[model samples]
Target: METVDVIVIGAGVSGLAAARLIARGGRRVVVIEARDRVGGRVHTDRSGGHITDRGASWIHGIHESPVAAAARAFGMPMVEFTVGGYQPDSRPLTYFDARGRRLEADAVRQYAADIRTLNAALAKIIAGAGAEATYGDAVERALAEQDWDAERKERVREYNDRRAQEQYGVGMGELGAHGLDDDTVNGDEVVFPRGYDELATNLAAGLDVRLEHLASQVDRSSEGVTVVTDRGVFRARQVVITVPVGVLQAGDLLIEPPLPETHRRALGLLRMNAFEKVVLRFAERFWDAGVYGIRQLGDEGEWWHSWYDLGRLHDEPALLTFAAGPAAVATRTWADEDIVASTMAQLRRLYGDTVPDPTSAIVTRWQDDPFSRGSYAFMLPGSVGADHDDLAEPVDGVLHLAGEATWGDDPATVPGALLSGHRAAQNVLGIDIPVSELWA
Candidate 1:
């Protein structure tokens, strides 16, 4: 039996970051991970002569972000994530009609303005609605009250659906109108051209990371905590559990005394969303230059609605698209060939029949991954942001919880997970630590 001052579960950014801070504070720590690799959901695939991030890809925001600060310290180069991400006004895009004909520049810009107006209107509805109201209901009422033409209404509705999938991995109706939280920074979001998982790798350096060690149970007491794993058992003065909320919800790892009532209440309200990415590579750029993003209102539900020209981040000729919520659920049993074929049909609808086949393709099925269970956390009706804080509270002041789901301000982000770890370390040390000691 091995022992340490602290034991951290899950080698994801959260766990690694907590372990790093604890170690730097002169405390012994060990990290247990079920997978052979680090960066639980920040996976980067460098196969087939391509650098593609199959999981989390953005810094969300650069200012006041620990992850961004770490990237800067490592001298890593990053470019602003300016592709038309739900909010199209951030960057110029090549817009297409249902028939694949590119829309005029003025028309595309108009859509951006319309979306902004629509978003503002929806925000007001949410603000005025009660906690029992769903975002889907708010969107529906807003759209119903609009006096726009049928064609314009249809366009905005379609774009709104796609944006819902991209942001929440589910329909707006599935999200809580009063509970949704998206805390943003003052600066632009950014991504690393090389890989997003490098942060996890660098953070894991010099730490005691036990790969392939699946934690099955945690028994806590006043004196210490005992962590039971498939490989062995270990004890520590305290343990920080950084596994995904999905894992805890599924009872994959049992806590002997169970979580506090408040923790369980919060946990019950949080849902792990289905957000998957598909990476397509071609021999050469196919779309127009100076147009980094391509959005199409395809027919038949538009399974693939948005795409980005990865060349902006040095992934030349590669395209990235996301399928979330219902779209992702619909493709749960889809094979690789089926996904590529279906996506190709959509591309052909927009790029004519002469479009060539991609040299390679990478698809993610985070929903099916047992270790992660799903991508990230989203709130349901009757839930509130304070639920995240409740879920993050340390049990008995010995069993600390930390993860993206545990962070309310910036949930479902890499920085959220990274910062949650630092907070957990602070909990373990029983003091407030400065940011310089953690990231510097």
Candidate 2:
């Protein structure tokens, strides 16, 4: 059996980050990944001269994001989009209703006000009724208190639902009322015109990474830890399990003697959400090229609610549709032909009847993937602040866990995963590294 100072599971950003830091500290490390390639959920696929990100795409905080720093270090070109901006030539986001009517200034203002009212009501509910309240319940209470008519109420509700789905990857009912209030690194978001997976590729450089090695079990002892994989077994003094929350929840990798009660409970308190993307390549640019994204309230729930103009990023006549929460789950049951047809119908509703069929299309089914059962993690309604900390705690100083799920403030982001890995490395090395330096 091969042995090392540390054995890292999953070669995603988190595992790669941990291995890199530990190896830089003069400790031998090896990363075992189930996938044939690196970058678990940061896959970038190219087909017919078009590049599409099947997994994670954006650097949510370019200035402070470790992924962005890695991209810069790797010399990857990035493009920035002004979110929610409405300049005539540089419009980033445009909202439309079921009839394809663009949301005017007055309606947009009303929606913002309604959202503010809803958030304030939710905060009050959390303060009075505690953290057990669901975001859906809070929104309902707030909407009930408003004196709007049925049409306005329905419109606001739909907008709220879309926002919640996009942010949480689940409906408001399943999301905690206080979940959206968590702090995260703040900066302008950017995208890699080439691919986001380049960041992971650069991070994994010079590291001992074993692909197609699926970890089946982890046996921990007072002295060290043993990791059993489909290929073989490896032992190490320390193990960093950086798999996604969905993989852990699915019990894909068994832990000998099981995890501690608190850890198990904490895992249960966190929920992995479903989010998927579908990319379509058309013969010509049928949609407006100036806009970065199009948000539509569709009558049929089959098509995606948001469409990203890939042309703006790479000058390709492609559009990527994003579906989250229930819509994403529902898409899992659709066949490619059916999904393509439905998407075309939805596009026709927005771009008129002359819309052309896509020459090529690609769909991402993260929910159905065995390695990643869902997109990412979110807190349940009853979860406390310490839940993520408890999840991150090392077991016997031999078994350490790190991933986006273990990151409390910025869960479900690439930078969050990287930060969690750095924190895990710090725990194993017994060293102090500034939080900012991890990204730098």
User: Which predicted model would earn the best lDDT?
Assistant: 1
lDDT of 2: 0.79
For residue 394, give model 1's deviation from the true position in Å: 1.2
Note the Cα lDDT for every prediction shown.
Answer: 0.84, 0.79
Stretches of model 2 off by over 4 angstroms after superposition: 82-92, 127-129, 183-185, 298-303, 435-440
Clashes of 2: 0
* Per-residue lDDT of candidate 1, residues 1-440 (tens digit): 89999999999989998999999989999999999999999888888677888888888667787788898887778988755246676767778877778888788887777777777788788777777887777777777777789787778877776776787787777888754447344477788899988889888989999999999999999998999999999999999999999999999999988998999999998899988888888888777787667888746436787888788888468788887888789888999778888888888877878899998888899999989999998888888777887877888889999999998887888888988998999999988887556557
lDDT of 1: 0.84
Which consecutive 10 residues in model 1 have the weakest lDDT in total? Answer: 178-187
For model 2, how does the per-residue alpha-carbon lDDT over 1-440 read when each residue is reduced to its tens digit? Answer: 99999999999988988888888888999999999999998899977677888888877657656677767767899888644111121344676766788878676666667666665666676655456887777677778887888777776677666666777688878887766655332566677889888878888889999999999999988999999998999999999999987888889999986889989999988888887777888889887657787777545533466777887678668888766788778777989877778778878888899998899999788888999888888778887656887888989989999988888867778877888999998998999766444434
